[model samples]
Target: MKKIIGVDLGGTTTKFAILNEAGEIEQKWSISTDIEREGINIVPNIIDSINQQLSQSGLSSTDVLGIGMGSPGSVDIDKGTVIGAYNLNWKTLQQVKEQIEAGTSIPFYIDNDANVAALGEQWKGAGEGNANVVFITLGTGVGGGVVAEGKLVHGAGTAGEIGHMNVDPNGYECTCGNVGCLETVASATGVVHLAQDYAEGYAGDSELKGLIDQKQEITAKIVFDQAKKRDPLAKKVVDKFSFYLGLACGNIANILSPNAIVIGGGVSAAGDVLVDGVREYFEKYAFPPVKTSTEIKLAQLGNDAGVIGAGSLVKMSR
Candidate 1:
């Protein structure tokens, strides 16, 4: 059976996998991303990794169909170039596809990291068998992808940026230099910021307050844990977080009207607590038809979403 290579590149590490057309991973591993020298080393490192894996598995380049990759920032998919990946300190466009293809003599396909994750879910996870869906990732930052009418919406190569949707006019400024973006209130960092703001003024007793008083770092998990215990401050923060998240989902629903919204990333590990809270608000703010039509659920693929989605790209092309 023909196999394909899938790569999920991040600021800190890059995940690599070998998978068959069925989307089952045969081998998977990761390596630290060397962003030194304007990320010039990234492609070479990936090529070396792929070759090493192939050697260990006693496979050859001819045994693979192609390679698919997910990366951060805007991508010129048609041109096979990355417009920009700020987190990787890639300040300028990079010829990622060309470099990889040249190194391995194999074809390469690429897309934004979030978009590929969405495609992954659509192929084999929560969105299995569904053509239209939205995939949202709530990690240190928020990222989103949308598929409409059985097609991924590239929208001039910058579509599916759900994180930047202005949800708060007077909210905190986002790293993207936007004010009150959905990412500012719903991302992991946003959750911690909300908890910190509440803990500062809270005179009442709460574990969140204790964490603040002890000068310990506050995290979304800590807030959720306290909220589960019914701590007033944590509950308030979680409620606010859920409300903002719901409002964002409602807005997306009104715009795209996708069949399902799949939530993923590290923060999503909170599971039902997070999904239930967001759903409560999503139903309230969504348009009448949207509220009834869209099914909000957790991402089933977890960390594998990126690679699986990338691998599926090869299948999609055929």
Candidate 2:
């Protein structure tokens, strides 16, 4: 059986999968991300894992089709180097593709993690093969991928960074050192930040405020759950969160006019409520033509979007 190796290299864990042409996972596994020496050992560890897996599966480099990866930070695809991925300890330009191909002697392909995820959705998930699509992931931080004319857009290595869009000039500071980036209030932590901001001096019997008063952990999940029950404070947070995100999406729609803007990542699990709220604002802010043509939908592949999308890099190359 012909095989393709897909790697999703994340900060906490690196997930690997062997996928068939049908995009079905024949096997999958993960290893804790190597943190020693700013990821100096990460490449070696991954190569070793591939060799071990291939050996056990009675496969060899010649038997496999190719390998692809979705890695954090901006990727210089032609050079296979990763730039400024702080979490991965890949602080400088590392020849990721060259090192990996040398280690395994197998053809390798790569792209930004978010871009690959977008391709995955475009190919087999919510996008359903739409030629023009946008993928927005609301995790601890927000990430985005823009696809146009059936290809991922990586302009100067950082084109679809929707998370950094200037949503508020006076908003909270983001990890990117920007004030009021979309991520400051639209990500998972953004939900929590909204909840905490609304918790102070508001007197209408708010469970979210109570959680804040007691110095307890407040998560986006709790805020979303409370919103479901019509908790005023939680509703306020969700409404505001949805506003900025939708506005950002609206602006993007005007520019790219993608077929669908697929929302995913952990926060998207709130389901219809999140989608509906964003849709309400998206309609308000989007251009009339874009409003009529573009669709906003939730992602279908879940965690698998990464690996499947990574595999798609090689698949498309072939």
Candidate 3:
């Protein structure tokens, strides 16, 4: 039974999984990223961990077919080099790859984590069987990926950056150095900021305000809980959040014309309130064909998508 190692590296935590050739996850594990201490040390440590995992089952490095990884940054897939990840504080993937290969013989593959997640959905999750799909991850900030013509679009490191797309010229400033980027009003940070702004005059009796200890520490989850409890301020905040989110989705749909759009990430935990709102706004704003043709669905793989997608890419690249 040939198996591939999937490693999904994040700023806080890195997830690992052993996936079979048929797309089944046979085993999984996790660990803190801790890349800030010595970013170059991650590769060898990861290799040791994978070997340790296989040892438990009387398996050796030879039993593993390949390694696939998803990280945060621009990756040159053709060269297996990660240009640099602002979040990971790493400049190259080749060094990381060389370190791992020095201890192990299996070939390794890598890509941007968002692109990996999109590939995961397309290959084995929500967008399974679809040739084209887009994944939008709404977390502290927005991240997105596009899969078209049965492939993840890699337009010279410029692909899958929809979050930076400007949705409002007169809106809030985005950390990406853009004014009114879509993420400014649609991500978790955006949602919380919107909630706080809306809670200005109604700060006294607002359920959201009551739930948090300090008014300055309110979160999008807090607003979501309040909305679930029927708080008017929360509802207004969510409505605005969804409106912008949907507008962004509609624009992506109109431009890309993907078969489906998959939504994921932490903010997606809000469930129906978040999804329904986006759907409503999407239908209203998208062009007729786009509105009726493209289906929007929630991602099913959750945290495992990155690793699975990364590992799967190894097989595809072969």
Candidate 4:
């Protein structure tokens, strides 16, 4: 039976999975990313882990179709190079393909982490059977990917950067050195920021206010939990977060008009609360045609989206 390896490379850990052509995970595991030497050992470490897994499974090189990987930072897919993955201390373009191929002697395909996640969702998760879709991940920072006309759109190798979409020119500054990017208002950090800002002037009684009084750090989960309980301040924070997220989605709808907008990541764990709230605003801000055409939903793949999407990359290339 032919199998493929799916790799989700993150700043701290790298997840690996073996999948058959049917997209079922036969086995999966992970290893801590070795970034001690400017990430020089990252690729080598990945190769070693792969070899170990293959040996343990009694699988040979010929039985494997290829390897697919999802990595952070800008990627030159054609060259299999990472332009810059700052979190991994990769400041220069690294020859990810050549290095990994040299080690494993298998063809490798790579893409931006967000893009692969979107691909994964489209293949077997929330966007399954849909050719046109957009995936937004609201984690520590926002990330986005777009699949248009049954293909991943990578115009100039920088397509689907939904998080950087300018939402508020005068709003909070984003880590991307921009003011009020969608990430600043719709991500996990953004939610907490909104909660803190709302608490400053809120005189009403709320659990968030008590946390503030106690100098306890507030999180997006806390805000969502409080809002579900009808805490006024937390509700306000959620309302603001949803508004910006919806506005961004509306803009995307106007531009791409995909079949569905799939939401994922840590913040999305809030489930219906987050999806329903964003849909409300998306409908309000989007054009009528776009509003009715696009469906908003949560991603079903969870952490597996990355690995499955990576595996899909190999299948797509074949």
Best lDDT goes to which candidate?
4
| Model 1, span 1-318: residue lDDT tens | 999999999999999999988888989999999999888898899999998889899998999999999998788787788866887889888998898999888889998899999999998899998889999999988988888887888886678778898888999999998799988888898999998888888999887899888999888998888888998899999999999989989989888888899999888988898899999999999999999899899999998999999997777777
Instruction: Give TM per candidate.
Output: 0.93, 0.93, 0.91, 0.96
Q: Considering every candidate listed, which one attains the maximal TM-score?
A: 4
lDDT of 2 by residue, 122-191 (tens): 9889997689999999999899999899888888768878999988889999898889999999889999
Q: lDDT for every model?
A: 0.90, 0.91, 0.83, 0.92
Off by over 4 Å in 1: none
lDDT of 4: 0.92
| TM-score of candidate 3 to 2 decimals | 0.91
Tell me the lDDT of model 4 at 295.
Answer: 94
**Residue pairs clashing, model 2:** none
- Give candidate 2 regions above 4 Å deviation: none
| Model 1, residue 17: C-alpha shift (Å) | 1.3
User: Which digits, one per residue and each the tens of the lDDT, describe model 3 over residues 1-318?
Assistant: 799899998877789998998778988899876576447666667888887888887777788888998977777765667757766667654465666666777788888888999999888988998988999998887898899988789887678887888878888988978798878888888888787677766655676855443645877788888888988888888888888888888998998888899999998988888889899999988899999888888999988899889887887777
Model 3 score (lDDT): 0.83
Kindly indicate the candidate among 1 and 3 with the higher lDDT.
Answer: 1
Residue 183 accuracy (lDDT) in model 2: 92
Let me know the TM-score candidate 4 reaches against the reference structure: 0.96
